[model samples]
Target: MKIYLNDQLVDADEAKVSVFDHGLLYGDGIFEGIRLYNGCVFKLEEHLERLEYSAKAIMLTMPWTRQEISDAVCETCRANGLKDGYIRLVITRGVGSLGLSIKNCDKPQLIIIADTIQLYPKEFYENGLPIITVPTRRCNPAALPPTVKSLNYLNNILAKIEAQHLGYQEAIMLNDQGYVAECTGDNVFIIHKGVLITPSASAGALKGITRDTALEIADELGIPWREANVTRYDIWVADELFLTGTAAEIVPIVEVDARKIGDGKPGQITARFLEAFRRRVCVEGTML
Candidate 1:
């Protein structure tokens, strides 16, 4: 395997970062999870754009332009002979002293890894996944906006651990106000009376790239869609429930909190959106 570090591609075993890096010390970093299909990078521009936004939000300057970053990603994929895989792009505050100030850091470090990732099994995609709502509420936006995909994922990790202990594959997190935020690593969407609904950004949900694509698919398929604040009850009685993410793609949620969602099966609209999403990705992407 090959990893893109700084500006050079190196063997995975040789790819290394400083132990004093603030990204590892204080979680001062941002990242993006991208997908490549048939040598094509899916929504490369959008992912880069989001990466830039996150960097800016965290005051981390990028040494390379967006185009250069994109090229590096393609180059790394080619170097690894990856026709289909996942890409993890990370920008971290470089080596720094044991202090809480960014002034201690010198520069930023960039790393890109292209590898295969199976976020969920094939059977889960077909039979739908059972999830639970955890007590770990999402981090407040005022503290750290969910829109920025940062390296500090302890909140979600705790929720995931709770779900795992309970024998569930994933966990849903609510905002401080008790509104449905999202899942551990995916955006949540539910269908109610033919309308596609998801939490707005203000609800502490990450503005996911795949979540936006799903909205576009809904529009193309003539399915009514809107963003609004949703509660646990909305999901409990929703006609269908699903999640979207760069890795998770689109997968149905059959049960939440052990209660069956809409006859405990993948709903018709969910299936339609999933099919449309798959077709869209195969034909629409940046050629590697």
Candidate 2:
């Protein structure tokens, strides 16, 4: 596979980062997971904007201009012959010393990888995936803001591991205050009383690009959608449950914890959103 490192596209095995790179040593970096469909990048500007937002959050400056980065992504996609695939763009505090000072690190790494990704099995999407609410609460935004898409994903990974051990495909993490924050890698939502509701950013949820797009789609379809702090009580009594992310897209949650959601099947509104979401991606955004 071809990887975009700096301004060049090279074999993945050959692309390298400095050992002292803070992104590797101290997780001092930000990233974005983007999608390309039919040779066109989905919400390319929004993803870049978020990447910049994350970089700024950490006081790191991107070495490449946004246009340069966008071009590199397209070039990587073309080189890899990707019709539909995932893009992982990363920027890190480059080559800093072991003592955690950013002074010596005069460079930042810009790496982009374009490839296919399927976070869950096809059957899971077909049958609706089950989610377990793990005990591993989300990292408090006060401790480390969830808005910054940093490399430190151990918290989310641990929850996912718990889900795997429990024989479920995905897991949800609650915030410190016992509100439903998000899944291991996706923001979650539920339909209640004909309204689509999701945890707000203050709830410790990642402000997911796909999550916002789903909200827009909901509005377009005349399905009421709103952002608010969501608790377990909301999840248990909701008419429908679903999760959204760049990679996960839109997936129905048939069961949360031990309770069945909407007759233990994908609810009508969940199905509707999924259908609308699936159709919107190919039609929306910048096409290559």
List TM-score per model, in order.
0.99, 0.97
* Local accuracy of candidate 2 as per-residue lDDT tens digits, 82-165: 989999998888887897889889789889999999998887777888788898999999999998899889999999999899
Q: After superposing candidate 1 on the true structure, give the runs of residues whose Cα lies further than 4 Å from its correct spot.
A: none
Worst 10 residues of 1 by lDDT: 279-288
Instruction: Write candidate 1's Cα lDDT for 1-288 as tens digits.
Output: 999999999999999999999999989999999999998999999999999999999888888999899999999999999999999999998999999998879889989999999999999899999999999999999999999999999999999999999998899999999999999999999999999999998999999999999999988999999999999999999999999999999999999987899999999999999999989886677898
Q: Which pairs clash inside model 1?
A: none
Q: After superposition, which runs of candidate 2 have C-alpha atoms over 4 Å from their true positions? A: none
Show how many residue pairs clash in every candidate, following the order shown.
Answer: 0, 0
lDDT scores of the candidates, listed in order: 0.94, 0.89
